[model samples]
Target: MDNLTHSFVGAVLGQAGLKRTTGLAMPALIIGANLPDVDAACFFWLEGTEHLAFRRGITHGPPALVLLPLILAGILWAFDRWQTRRGTRPEARLPVRFGWLYGLAFIGCLSHPALDWLNVYGIRLLEPFSSQWFYGDTLFIIDPWLWALLIGSVGWSWWREKLGGDQRPIARGAIAVMLAYIGVNGAITWLDNATRGTMTEPYPRAYIAAPLPLTFWRREQIAQLEDGRWISSDWKGSDFGYGYANSDQRQCRLPDLTEARRTNSQLDAFLFWSRAPFASRAADGSVILYDARFYDPRARDRFSVALPDVECVELSAG
Candidate 1:
């Protein structure tokens, strides 16, 4: 999930009870919720390292989700206890208050990974022992509709509160809507999978379909298949194209196991954990890497490729 979504969820949780239980603790809770992303800072330190981006790494892992808040809570508690011993009366109960604070913070933080799992990118709910990626494949990385629905509902709730109308119902209703959307999308994806199986040889390898620019029109679906091929279709139209070589022409030798381990280790840990990883060398000698993180084959294009110093195409153009 995106940071905005995580923050919004944190804010929602704060509104639910964290704010009432501990006023200033809300910020701590929110930070804890987003703390898993602290690995993002790695980009500054580990430039050039594979997957070293903050999105994949310890901070985003399950271990961090479980332990970071507890660690933070202990530190806050210890600081408050120290202040109390120094004759700060208000600080005496700070440790006790922080217990609730930490609890709320943990919940807010966990929500991030939970939501992320809904997308094609996987999460390591259990890590250390395994790094297999998993995903529900129901939503796009960025879904305008989801953002609109959630933000709109939250905004409406705020408006209702200002007017002295009950707001909890609105918030609850919004959450229900979000859940319903997830369910409907999941069903649609399942149906899409069923449709995919009906195709004959040169099966579609990757695809993405969602509500398009137009509403009445069915969603647009784009796919890449085994051969150097492409297909685009919609609920309303059937269109296809193939321009590249067969699948065999595109095949290449993969990186060795040692290279795989080294590259995977270097990648954003969260991203590595979220996708099926593959490495190959293109005919032009460029490296091609694939992270099944995003279920779509288009994601396969994300792999790096080396460019030749000079080519026949350049000479022809000259």
Candidate 2:
């Protein structure tokens, strides 16, 4: 999920009455909720798909869940003390307790991976211990409807807080509504998976069946057939939104850029991260690599490389 969603969730929690627990409680919650994304700093040094190899991995794993929050709690604790020494602490600020801050930090940090799992981009919750990817396939990475619900409650809570009224009920209601929405989407994913599972037998290679953005009822299913063909369609219930792909671009190559992978470290990272990878040849014979999961005409896919002037295209026989 995006940072705004995470921040909104934290704000909702604070508005739901967690704010009374300690000074800087809201900051602890909001920042800790987005703390797992500290790994985003890797983009400074990492190029291309190196992000996939690292992000949402150990940072979102069980160990980091504990340690990262501890660090955040310690920081907030120090900040509060510093404010006290400077005599600039807010008059209404509650007494800061390390334990309370730690608890909030833990709650906030834990929410990070759980929300991240709600998207098609999977996360490794157990990383370092295991490299497997887990997907919720529930919410889109960004959902305007979700934004409306969260922001609505947050805005209402802010107004009520200023007016000196209990806003917990409203915040709680928003949380409940969001959870119900997630459950509905989960059912949609289950049905979508069941539908795609049946169709995969005809392809029998690799596939990704994930929820699309804008609407939870719709899904985008992309696959590579046993014979090196790519097929994609959007599903709403049992009906396909755009029908099955019949365009020339629908035919995809199961590219084996093994030698190329060996020569280029970035390509190696891309291959490791690509779930439904396929390749096509550019006019200059360079291999244009893509993950079928993210293939769309409107968005630009950048995983292409020069195929070293060799016959690298190989389709599965059986």
Tell me, by TM-score, which candidate is best: 2
Show the lowest summed lDDT stretch of 10 residues, model 1: 309-318
Model 1 root mean square deviation, Cα atoms: 7.1
- What's model 2's lDDT at 57? 91
**Candidate 2 per-residue lDDT over residues 202-274, each given as its tens digit:** 6546566677778668877766666665556653222111222422222235455678678787678777766
Give the lDDT of residue 171 in candidate 2: 94
Residue 228, model 1: lDDT of: 25
lDDT of 1 by residue, 35-97 (tens): 777766665665343442334345657778778888776776676667668886473232357
Supply the global lDDT for candidate 1. 0.55
Error of 2 at 233 (Å): 0.8
Candidate 2 has what TM-score?
0.87
